[model samples]
Target: MLFGAGAGMLAGLACGGGSGDDARPAVLAHIGHDVAAPAFATLHERAGALVAALEPLCAGPDATTLAAAQAAWSEERDAWSRVLPFGFGPLPPELNALDFWPVRVDTVETAVAGAPAAADAGYLGGLGVSAKGMPALEYLLWGEDPGAALTAFQSEDGARRCGYARALAVDIEARTDALATAWASEYADALATAGTGSAAYPSLKAGVDEVINKSIDACLTMVKGKLDNPLGNLSGAAEDPSLMESRFSGRTRADLQANLAGVWAVYHGADLDAPAAGISVLVAALDPALDERVRAQYARTVEVLVAVPEPLTEALVADRTAVQLARDELDTFRRLLKLDVASTLGVTLALSDNDGD
Candidate 1:
């Protein structure tokens, strides 16, 4: 679930305590109650809206209904993007079920051909990763064009596609609802109780370290998974467009922005509304100058992302300079995050073991 950026810098705020003050407990509480719980709530709500939006489209398969469903999908996806920064514990499994990309098209095709009785949660949940989730929905809704997809849904065999799409939405809704419940009830306590007489973590520092680890992973994903790999930086040619996140919808840029939003959420310790004590406060207390540098870097990264044109798949090929510029700027931010923020906070990043780009 962890991803990164949003507006309003979390820097420049004053801290009452000096470098020696330990605010990990407070930070964890704020993240659990204000940040993670609320993000899951929003995800559940938006997912519900998507399920409802898809109902009419599946039944009628018209352009108007298809458009409505697409809009709902974009909203739900943005909500999911904001939720990415907390992609730890239960979130990762749910994310794999919901947004795993480069979907196994053949698997999905086979499932649709079989035509299950209903697209209920159990049925969809039992299906393979590539055969279900948002990516599959993207394939169904945006295949060729909305109009053509709708026409296919109206054909003699259209019921099968409609059934699968409905099932996918229902499964997503179920997973999000389960996530919200788990975070609010079970995981939030574990996070809030981190470092204090807890078996899960030895110290409050451990909890904070988890946040740092996820944040760095989000930054790494931005630099490597999202941009460089797809752009073919190693091979000296852009890879297939299908490699890009949000490739079906051409909203990869928005996904990148949401990545930053997740980072912003963690940096600020809360979302825009609930600004409780966060890593920023700890960093400010320890080294205010370093804090300012990290914030400025975050702002610069957001600015670079803002400048990149939409439809990132095309941007990778035709507008290589713009994509490269954004990537370079994000790389700088990632380094600052690793060097200054993590160092000053006394945390270490555990880079992924899997070496493939």
Candidate 2:
């Protein structure tokens, strides 16, 4: 769902804390709650603007570099747009790099051989759907015109087995991991190509990954809490009446608005309570294999990239003056990058992980 630039930028502003404070944690500081379906629509418009801006840069950074950038960008942006009806989660950076951006780059570099590109996109799409939860439920639960929309989403009758409402969560949770593995398999050769260390893409990748991990945790922690369903299923509520009220009884348009205020406070460097459901669920599903992959991805970005992203590697070993100059230049580039969408469309993207379940 996309709106005009104002709607999209407003939605972007409604996201995690913006700036002015260096002491604040980027993810925890913002993670806004004021986001709604409209805001969610706004978000996509803004991201689309970003994708449009990145098109030229995506092309100039060499085939392999562009491939990686496009992969991360596509994964993040597609997942965001695809999951609209359900709601939104912050687009963490790492997942964007590993799964989405490469595919995007490949699409530009080699669209004729789309088989390869599709695989990469499919894989990240799978991974992303696996991770989406709250957005799914938010739409499933309250994304309609109070009575009519609510009944339709919740209705379990003919013509509405699963509506556009929790499909994303189902896709991501059940089918994504395998699909992502396949995406990786499809683009093995292209993905294997070494990228020039100069593209600051790796830093962005690291940031995206961190944010995804945190969001995963946040989703897990929701269990038994307001949004909790032990199995983390979007359909869990539709199946069990008690579960729905227990989790969302107190929730409303106003509550989400209030939560956004809390998110703003975080940006301002205020202490905020961690989401009980999100984080807990994520940790529960963590495995040694996934952990290893995450580490390797982190290492690859930090070790190979020129930028100084946190958590991917150690302290910067570059010349201090040169690094400062580079940082300033990058900042300038970032500022030049304004988000604007060609057109805005309203579509209900169901965010669910019930693909298998």
Best by lDDT: 1
Q: Give one digit per residue, the lDDT tens place, for model 1 in 8-122.
A: 1122112222222346677777877878888899989999999899889877887788889989988888988887778786788767788878766678778788767465666
Segments in model 2 whose C-alpha atoms lie over 4 Å from true places:
1-34, 62-309, 312-357
| lDDT for each residue of candidate 2 in 13-106, tens digit (9 for 90 to 100) | 2232223331112332132222222233443443444344333332333334333433433333343332222212222332333222111222
Q: Total clashing residue pairs per candidate? A: 20, 60
TM-score of each model, in listed order: 0.89, 0.20
